[model samples]
Target: MSRAFTREVDDAPPPPILERAISSARNLVTPNGARQIEQAMETLDRQIEASGDSEALAALRRELRYWHARHARMEIVEPPEAPTIVTFGTHVTIKRGGEPKHLHIVGEDEADPAVGTIAWTSPLARALEGARPGDVVEFQAGGREEEILVLSVKGASQ
Candidate 1:
């Protein structure tokens, strides 16, 4: 090969971007979760308007679409006035291995396990759903079944 014999294609179109995956589970969201989704869409819109790069715009647009879909399918589930059982939009306290863990059952989009929020459709939440105080639930984790004792279930605000 001689000096500079390769041809760079500058006019070629960029690769197509993949769309975000949408969950098939019920799109139940808490009031706060709905607000978070709206905020995300708004932020994305601003970024899309300010972006000058095509690739960046594409990514922003893709994200916006995801948020839009989530917003469209969002079913706001209000917290019960006095939650007596573990359910969506409820705060649950469970005792496992002699340790008490507090978790909020919320929508998938706003779930952050690090902050003690779990998606309603998650295995732990599913296992806890409908469980009342003093009830022991069997939860499968890491290929082992663990017992979780429901200590208390209350409204998210409480």
Candidate 2:
């Protein structure tokens, strides 16, 4: 048999790997967001220290990479000195769809709607950024469009 005909053949080429995606938006973080990232890193470090499985360690490393990037770009925006007007780290109360909603404008990582915190870049927060008490702002949420009234503007503390 000819060498060319007798040569062993590889069955198939491996599938292409798609690289993980990362956000390009500015990593704007509140004090709490920064703290959360730090806490995550600490936890990841502990896991990495105790882990012996190669696959699990690889996954942890991937997460560490993301957290590292977030930490590097972290911008801790403190509450505005006066907080008279709505801004980052400001707490605002609004009436949306006739229901009262109290939320704080925080960083994306620190957002927890169940806890009454929304990311600053969120549509509702953007709409309410400059609004003061009694000012009505339009909001589009859950495919429904409506106006939200700013009921009150409080400092970040409250």
How many angstroms is residue 74 displaced in model 1 relative to the true structure, after the best TM-score fit? 0.6
lDDT of 2 by residue, 1-158 (tens): 55676534444554444334666767788887999999999999999999999777878888887889889988888887556678888888998767999998888878999999998888888988888898988888889888888998887555
Query: Candidate 1 — what's its lDDT?
Result: 0.93
Candidate 1 lDDT, 80-133, residue by residue in tens: 979888889888999998999999999999999999999999999999999999
lDDT of each: 0.93, 0.83
RMSD, one per candidate, in order: 2.6, 3.9
TM for candidate 2 is: 0.83
Quote the positional error of residue 11 for candidate 1 in Å.
7.1
Q: After superposition, how far is residue 8 of candidate 1 from its true place, in Å?
A: 11
Model number with the top lDDT: 1
Q: What TM-score does candidate 1 get on C-alpha atoms?
A: 0.91
TM-scores of all candidate predictions against the true structure? 0.91, 0.83
Off by over 4 Å in 2: 1-20
Judged by TM-score, which candidate is best? 1
